[model samples]
Target: MKVFLWNETGKEKEIMLEDDQITVPADKGKYIYEVLAEWKNGEISYTFVAEVQ
Candidate 1:
C-alpha cells in the first residue's frame, strides 16, 4: 500500500505511513489524497479530499 497527498499548490508528495496509518498535515487547509493498494490478483486506487480547520 502507498499513500500520496497534494496541496493547493498542486504539488504531489508521498506520505509515510506508520502502522497502516497516516498523519495529516498540521497546516490548516484543504488537501487531496490518494490511496493505492496492489496485489497479485489486482490493484485499486481511490482519492479523497480532507479539510483541516
Candidate 2:
C-alpha cells in the first residue's frame, strides 16, 4: 500500500509500508500522513490490506 508522509520536522525521509509494518530509517525524527482519510499522525501508523503472498 502507498503511505503519505509529511516531514513534520521538515527533515527525514518517509518510509514505505511493507509486510504490515512501516519501516523507519536508522535516524529518528517526526512525520505525519499527508492523507488523512487513509492514515493518522503518530509514532507508528499501520494500514492493513490483502495482497498476493
**Which candidate achieves the best lDDT against the true structure?**
1
Candidate 1 off by > 4 Å: 7-11
Candidate 1 lDDT over residue span 1-53, tens digit each:
99899766764888899999988878898889999999999999888988899
Clashes of each: 0, 0
Cα displacement (Å) at residue 31, model 1: 1.1
Compose the digit string of candidate 2's lDDT tens values, residues 1-53.
Answer: 45654553642344566775665444444335432233355344453332222
- Candidate 1 TM-score over all chains jointly: 0.83
Badly placed stretches (over 4 Å) of model 2 are: 8-15, 34-53
lDDT of 1 at 12: 86
Task: Give the best candidate by TM-score.
Answer: 1
TM-score (all chains, Cα) for each model: 0.83, 0.34
The whole-model lDDT of each prediction reads 0.88, 0.45
